[model samples]
Target: MAATAVLQPYNEAQYDHRAFDSLMDVDESAYYFDSLTGYEHLRSGLRDIFMRHGVSDELAVALLHRHFEMSTNEKLVELGPVSSPWPIAAHEDSVLGGHILPHTWRVFENELHPLEFRFIPQQEFQDARKVQFSQAFFEDFRQYVKANGLENVVGITQLDHGRDADESDVQLMEVTHGRNSIMVPAVPSSDVSGPAFQTIWSFVEKQSSKLDADGIQTRHGLCYKASSTDAANDGIQTRHGLCYKATSTDASNDGIQTRHGLCYKASSTDAANDGIQTRHGLCYKADSTDATTDGIQTRHGLCYKANSNDGIQTNHGLCYKATSTNTTNDGIQTRHGLCYKANSNPTTA
Candidate 1:
């Protein structure tokens, strides 16, 4: 019997927008098949039909798995070919090989549609692995959401690779409110396959914050090798996900120099002559040696020594200039000949 001559079990009108919309309402439980044996039988039957129609086995298996996962009901059933005139059917109630069937089926006579199947070449599939994401895929997803009125809440569920060794990733994006979902290539079409999937994944991760439901969140930032001197001098940089520059510099002395952190010239010549002045702190002359009075005089009346001199000792005593040298002079004389009263009893000689 010719394949087209077979009577279609379901009506074409049954698989229209209404049927697709009905899919959005289906719960996750509908994806479970009755039994493993039943699933294998259904898969084998679909494989045979698909192969006979020139579809690759890998693609056939992938399509079948997707079909089963998105099926409105949980039962596994055998579906037969439809007649040429009405080759497509959307009604779910049909009996083939003593089993129930799905509401939609792609006819052998029709050209393959993107909505139904995707044929990725071996090289293309390999390329997708290196890619984390793609702008083309994002655009396609955006369009699909807009067209399907899924702008508000869209959920994407990634599935395992095919039963065979094919590592091609598959995902289904659906409107969370109803069963309006379809399987799409996890990576974008081959034309836009060079970008790593991580790039797009990150973008989604950052955008997820805006999503009410379980939508992907995308992160954003600048990435680049910063100029050794100034951030403003850094050249333009590009990244698929986010970009951020290294914010630290090699230490001048022993450790990393953070931005705006204290730093000094490390060269011995500069340190010996410049007296270890901080980039933004008080500058100490090289001749100063006293720890307390060795740097530039500050506003707090601390005397800074210029050439190792202790200067007037104002900390522990009161200085008083005497008319003449005498032990009765109420102040003790310092080695510099300045007289001052000590806080403790004065030492008399």
Candidate 2:
């Protein structure tokens, strides 16, 4: 609520009642009283009067003037302050980082979701016209979605409650999620029974559903990966069932697999052995060309080779550097002046 203001006494010497009389004739729908210099205090009381319960675009301007008179008339019954609240102003920032009545909000599945949204010009709020509200990602937010290759996001708003239809002024549910939900949230009012109060608060409360967070998401899991991580991570993250799509593929692999894989597992162990390799683990070959694909080489104490002329020869040079003058003979090597030859043929080794 706006803080109560410091009132000023009518100064009969400097100023006369003539100046205040002009304020009586102006209409209330869009009222702005002129300020005497250095008198910021006088503006607060008048400003408060304009900001009470939301004025609908459809409300008769004369009725609005009457309402204003009822609230501000000096001769009205002095029964003390009415059980009213501070008015919601267009530019005022709320504790929730948005407005009580968001600039533009959406409703889906009969639930209210207040958001800091905006609109494109049409006529006025009273005209049966349309506007845009942006969330998630879009080409450009301030521009009309139609202007930016998108259609308007369909939804509803309650101009009366200053909230979504589903949220009562005070929350009754005990929100729960470990430390994540124990924090206080800024609500419109604390009284649950308030005639026109609502909130988007966070509180500790028990949920009675048997399913986990997965169920509230209206999306089928096939489209996007739900974060087992953040509560709002690409999942049902808002009051209107704003679900971020799961990846088109189950990149998280949640509860989905090959149809054939599930069929075999359903059979009993006593059934005949399936004619397929059931072994499952990292498969490594004993001999994978005897070299790592990354170009790193490993070998035993002695090198080994497979030659067309010689099958699996040990202590052989698969590839080696020979820095010597060498000669070949019938399967024999002679001293420093080395000589080698095939056992059967002198031409090959």
Candidate 3:
């Protein structure tokens, strides 16, 4: 009798959204087989079918794994040529195998339609990675979301690279509640790849917010990025998510416009409008001159009580005055005391 391999029956949850580069040491136990002979026969059949059909060996193992997990029969019974659930592209070295299945697929009234597949060349994939992204990335992603017309991305799950990479740097990401995943790059980067997944999720969020019932950008300014620095120069800036930018200016004033919005001049008589100056060049705006509110609490605490008329008005509507004495604020105290903190409201030019 031939030695029978004790198969560790395929567990559906254990193999979700997995990616495998090579098939050299795939655990035979993870797959279901009646006998050692059955396993060998199945591998032979799969190898023959895949080789004849121009399927990569890596993808062959992946397809079988998927079939095993999804089928109710749960037996290694099929020896026929199997169509891949997803579009297949041949990798020169290893198959892009392992649970590369779609989370959901649509059927019409319980009738299965012929699925279409496309095989993109690996060189084209490499070429795509070189494209410079800024606004164009958002535009293309916006179109993708619009075409899919799917719901917002509710969650992001990282996938295992399956012995190909260390645990700290798995880059594959699955976007939940969306039509398909936002695949992370295969390259390992503990610092960049981890945050890249979050970036993708955030991009989805902004696009979804801008998308209306018709999946159009009819609701403007939701995910808006200033094409020119005109909006930033004018003190109208949106800081949330992808739209965040550092406040830079040529304006010589006590206050600076920032991503928070516009910083304006406050009335000195109203104690509520005056407080310690913050590093962003805004007054903390206290209701009363208490110990916490009156003292130099912040690093940019160049705040002082002075006449509103003594203040010089900024282009951004903020008030500033030249200080007589030096102070310990982050900026040079040659200019001192901002009257109001920046607000989310945009001022008209």
| lDDT on C-alpha atoms for all candidate structures | 0.24, 0.20, 0.22
Least accurate stretch of 10 residues (summed lDDT) in model 1? 193-202
Q: Highest lDDT: give the candidate number.
A: 1
Candidate 3 has a TM-score of: 0.20
Superposition TM-score, candidate 1 onto the true structure: 0.18
Q: Which stretches of candidate 2 lie over 4 Å from their true place?
A: 1-87, 94-114, 117-144, 147-349
Clashes of 1: 31
Task: Name the lDDT value of residue 316 in candidate 1.
Answer: 10
Candidates sorted by lDDT, best first:
1, 3, 2
lDDT (tens digit, per residue) of candidate 2 on 191-217? 111011011111111232221211111
1-349 in candidate 1: lDDT tens per residue? 1243333232222233222233311111112222223234222332233334322211212111121123332232211211011123334333332212222222211211111212224444443321121233333333543444332222221222221334322222111011112222222111110111110111111121122111111111010110112224343111111122333334443542222222344444445745654321133454544434443431111122222321111111011111122434332222112223322221111
Worst 10 residues of 2 by lDDT: 217-226
Greater lDDT among 1 and 2 belongs to 1
Candidate topping TM-score: 3
| RMSD in order of candidates | 34.8, 36.3, 25.3
Per-residue lDDT over 1-349 for candidate 3, one digit per residue giving the tens place of the 0 to 100 score: 1232443332122122222111111112122222233323223432233233322212212211111121221111111112232323321212342212222111212221111122224444443211111232223323432343311221111112122335423223211111121222222111110011111110111122212111111000011111223344444333211122334453335443332232433323233344432332234545433323332221111222221221111110111111111222111110012122112111112
The TM-scores, one per candidate, come to 0.18, 0.13, 0.20
